[model samples]
Target: MSNIIETKVCSEIGDIEGVILHTPGSEVENMTPGNAERALYSDILNLSVAEQEYKQLKQVLNKITKTFEVKDLLTEILEINEVKESLVNNICKSENVKPIKSSLLSLESGELARQLIEGVPLNKTTLTGFLSDERNALRPLHNFFFTRDASMSVYDHVLIGKMANKVRERESMVMEAIFNHSSKIKSKTLNPSSSKHHKDEITIEGGDVLVAREDILVIGTGLRTTTQGIDFIIKKIKKNKGKHSIVVQQLPSKPESFIHLDMVFTLLDRDKCMVYDPIIMQPNKYQTILISIDNGKVKKIEKQSNLVDCLRDLGMPLEPVYCGGKKDIWIQEREQWHSGANFFAVGPGKVIGYARNVYTLEEMNSNGFEIIDAQSVVDGKIQLSDYEKYVIAINGSELARGGGGARCMTMPIRRKKVDW
Candidate 1:
């Protein structure tokens, strides 16, 4: 096989080639009651629980794909002269830690890497530094564990996210550098803020965008991605000569659980999907609009019944599998809040998700899926590839509290094309 990795993700369900993941660090543990919400966490995760849960995910993924750690990728890319200098300068300036740039540059590669994600401690010598309660001169990227938000892969190109929150902006910048400058792969990078067609109002996050097929895309709009963001995607799709379509679904903003499209809906197979019943099945004022692009032009834009209905009309039909086992609405709501619908597909009929959502797992098991544990799969007690289709549920108690699941944590860069 060639050493150069190519970006070839064409479907949500495909044999995996490479995936991006970030190992949780002290940065995750650095959260306190004072800045928990600001750090994108309602409660700080117990590090031990998060790490154990994460190990299961890592081991399972390692068995299947060429897994890459974010810190290692960032460190490798930062070793380049121009890239290293520019990234540090930009990061320091943006976070207003210019005074520490020289000190930061002096650190060895290993130490520097840890500091970037875990954060740099305040000097505490100067009056301002002494009184500053902020542990980091540059704040920790507490949400870096959720690698999907910083960058996304679309066909052979990478879309560098423009975060709605400034705290996560550097995560985007770091991801952009890894995709653009790292020796890992070759792919074009698109920055929404600096794109020639970028709009002043456009705000997109990778968490909201789901790649269904080579020509079809499903996006959720709520807190992270907006109408302008969807329009921004439309402009990109309109430039392509081949067949392409964009399905935009508006998401609710109140309850934080409705953060991304995947939070409420995600693909389980070519013909099946996991969904939060209330938001997706039980219709509300939220709209599901489909935009058709015909030969680089806006051909049609119309409302559809729901996301499942829209995808079915477009010929990618998927039967809806409700989160929380399809029983009480209360059970559905409770589990949905914990990312019950969020699962990542490794291939058609083969997927992975959190095992804590027992109700959700029960639904999948009843639907002809052989449920397996992550450790079982990793230890060879269970074989994922042996079964044509299976749901591999991994434990994520503390990690789930971070408000994500398998789909939210993984950034799949490439997958074998489906027979479809």
Candidate 2:
């Protein structure tokens, strides 16, 4: 077995050292059009095409850093009898599938892991089961491929998600179990569910939180994350007793595209950021608030002029790259819907995003970022180190339909601290 993996994430633009990924599997294809909305998907994905597209991301990440698969890690820990029993018990109880406990415990670790994620089919032998319209005794995790949503690593601790949707609650439970029991992972887990201040409305998803720097956290509050959720995060920081800053951007509730902070804004480097102009830059009903915490207390709380201005005031001046381009608002709206602003930084000035956003890529090119195809890097035709600043564009035609981009799909566990 590999040595226990300690978690650490101090910056968004640092060189990634370790990351967790879940390749699209049957769990993704398990959903039907009827349940797509509940699954939080705008459209159903073609499994074959999605897998092909995902391979580009997986292969690119594999070449760059140490990558771990959730299933493999889950199976590794499930091999421990005590951990296995406790995890299964917790899952069955939390998910209201206690009837399957003995059966789950009876299976081998590998098979059990598969069933847990892909779902266990309902027997339908009993009268209640036969009469019920349910398809599985346990629901398949349809959105597991977007690993960034369930749990997030922030400066050595894993924050287990308190999901906004009941359907995704199991994903958090599964992730918490992995971080808690996986022999390969060594990290303290903070679960809002266990928090004394937690309430039904206090839900926070990983997609809404960004570790911009060791002492700075940029968060979004909207449909997915509530004020109470942000409050829980504030309490956590206060307990730590240090100078901490958080820039809270209020997101729109109407468009499903504005689901998280990363959807509209993401840090690309120590001095660069990508933003959708309408909400982030332009004056709107949604406000940006900055809160400063020092010496275990909130030193100041006030409304900020805007996300960009507030960030600059925090001493992290960033040059903004418009999502689609600076010319047209129409194109910006279209491309932002397709996740044009969502870029995942593997290192400062080194990132990955979709190539479909031609105008956005052009803007990046104008900003001196070399555009490289992910396939070229994967095939060894071009070395990534050859370019100091580059964007490896992956084909996200199919994956983008899943309503996320490179940043939304990744959950970076450990990153080398940036020399700011």
Candidate 3:
């Protein structure tokens, strides 16, 4: 396939045709204990180890379909003088470092792309800069490896994330610029911040939103995404002339592990979904609401029993697959923390996840998904076409520590429409 691709994702478990990835680079290793918390990480990661693990994912996806790296795409767009100026201006103005705009634009596209992801060293020429404790004038995007959080493709449009944390706002801006300026990709973008309904409380991350079907969306509201953020999506749906259903699942805000919906739930196949038992299956204070829209207006709004049941009622029944098996909640909690439930579907019934989550992999295996090592596929020792249902397991001892799984590390740009 050519590099020119149109962005379209009508379902969560569709066969992926094209995806965007960011291999963990100097940006990830640039963090220290002092700034780990600000970077949304519980602990600092070893770049070498993380890169080794990430290679499995990249190679497997490359074997299956077209894969575009974030750095490559950014570099391609930066080659255009107008786009280079506009993007540099946006980043500098947004970060309140307008003084460096001219310097940034002076660099070549490749070097400029490197500095945007990696940190640009603080120019200590100013007395205040010399006195500051900060290491980088524009902090490195430490969480950029988790490409799913910044922006997402919904149907034919890309919804630019209104990141909950200010530290990650640049990721969204970069993504918006890619979609708007990249000649290789064709799609429109919907930015919540650019809309009239934008507010401080309205924040939406890609990890919190799932496209269940062409007209159905399953979204989670918690710390990273707010009720107001879902409302912003609702407003956008209202403008379209068709019936749409949205399942709003409320997530707990206490544990940082529950920061996004993908941490506890993900679509694995046309008839199946992976879920954490405690929060998604068992009874709890968290509420699930169903909102129905028709002809540009909300037709009905009601509380749902749960996510699975809500989708079942909407004609998309999905059998729930336990993240850590159905036997013990203790094991479930341990595995869920490592993103056991986060599975990225390359095709219907074909998915990828962390190999460290043994119990979760066991549960998936028992449910008919053959456990295949990602390295085996990368080495040409195995072919995915030989299995009807399979999960490619990638080494994740280090990547999981970064608080995401295969699904979180990927952003699908184009998917083959599923034959429902």
Best by lDDT: 3
- Worst window of 10 by summed lDDT in candidate 1: 193-202
Whichever of 2 and 3 has more TM-score, that candidate is: 3
Worst 10 residues of 2 by lDDT: 194-203
lDDT of 1: 0.87
**Candidate 1 lDDT, 1-420, residue by residue in tens:** 777787767778888899999989899998889999998788889998898898889899998999999999888877777887888998998888899999888877667888888999889889998888788898899999899998898877888888889899889988988888878877788888885654567789988999899899999988999888888778887888877888898999878988899999998888999989888888799999989999989988999898888898888988889899877888888888888999999888999988888888889988888889788888999877689878898998899999899988999899998888
For each candidate, give its TM-score against the true structure.
0.98, 0.98, 0.98
TM-score of 2: 0.98
Ten contiguous residues minimizing lDDT sum, candidate 3: 192-201
The whole-model lDDT of each prediction reads: 0.87, 0.91, 0.93
Clashes of each: 0, 0, 0
Candidate 2: clashing pairs of residues: none
Per-residue lDDT of model 3, residues 41-74, tens digit only: 9988999999999998999999999998999999
**How many residue pairs of model 3 clash at the backbone?**
0
Off by over 4 Å in 1: 196-200
